[model samples]
Target: MQTDEEIGKVAAAVPVIISRALELFLESLLKKACQVTQSRNAKTMTTSHLKQCIELEQQFDFLKDLVASVPDMQGDGEDNHVDGDKGPRRGRKPGSSGRKNGGTGSKGKDKKLSGTDSEQEDESEDTDTDGEEETPQLPPQASHPPAHFQSTPRPLSSRCRG
Candidate 1:
């Protein structure tokens, strides 16, 4: 708009037009979401419901990516599970414990794991009376983590925004 000199003055009613369009869109979405919730016998609408609503309607095709990225605010059940976990539902296939960075990120193969229940179970001489290997004691806060352990992620922040 700054460079386009031929374009006439921006109309004052443009804002109102945009507002009306957005309002109609949101109103239709909420209405359809409510219907979907009712069909699913749910008391409250959820992200899954909204996503399904968007997927069902051809007009909402553009918003599929947007809703797909949105995390479900209310985790009701199988429909609202976190991303990648589609749940062992009727149609969807069971999911696997996904490897970090697609099985290439972990340096576990190079690093020797000790007293860990890893796949390479070499019969070491460190067995107890019960024929079970003794678990290694966790390192203190000042020291490094166990050799078997990977990167230590920080704890999650509190939900309350004080």
Candidate 2:
């Protein structure tokens, strides 16, 4: 049997450790979700982006049921409210089709590649040097500690012989 103080310390440390782990998991998940959104030429992340990330990645499949399906919000003059339910609205009915806002099958006619895509295209073009020797690119340098972080070596002064 452990003392009360020992049990209390363990209990407190467990929550802190769990919270830190949760924070890290959420951070990585969101980062991947953001990448998925940007890949599809979206400025703002939507449920579809998150869904795509969850669906495509096997590691995130467990969260599929937890990610609520959100209604499409791109139509003109259509309000998102659903009979006074101030919560996330459900997506379109299982069978409706046509050029409607938020429909999975419909793509926006005005959709265009975002800046990142164009930049990536430009980079690819630059890399194609038509038979020239390609130089190996170096990985980005890791960040180093500041000069102030370095400890100076101390010299021992001559003192009375011990």
Among all candidates shown, the one with the greatest lDDT:
1
lDDT value, candidate 2, whole model: 0.53
Clashing pairs in 1: none
What's the lDDT for all of these models? 0.58, 0.53
Determine which window of 10 residues in candidate 1 has minimal summed lDDT. Answer: 124-133
The sequence of per-residue lDDT tens digits that candidate 1 reaches over residues 8-112 is 677888778989999999999999989888776555567778988898999899999898886643443434345665442332123431232333212324334
Q: Report the C-alpha lDDT of model 2 over 46-135, residue by residue, as the tens digit.
A: 676676677778888799887657543343333333334454334334454322233222122212332356644643453344433334
Query: Runs in model 2 with CA error above 4 Å?
Result: 1-10, 68-162
lDDT of 2 at 69: 73
Index of the highest-TM-score prediction: 1
The TM-score obtained by model 2 is 0.37
What clash pairs does model 2 have? none
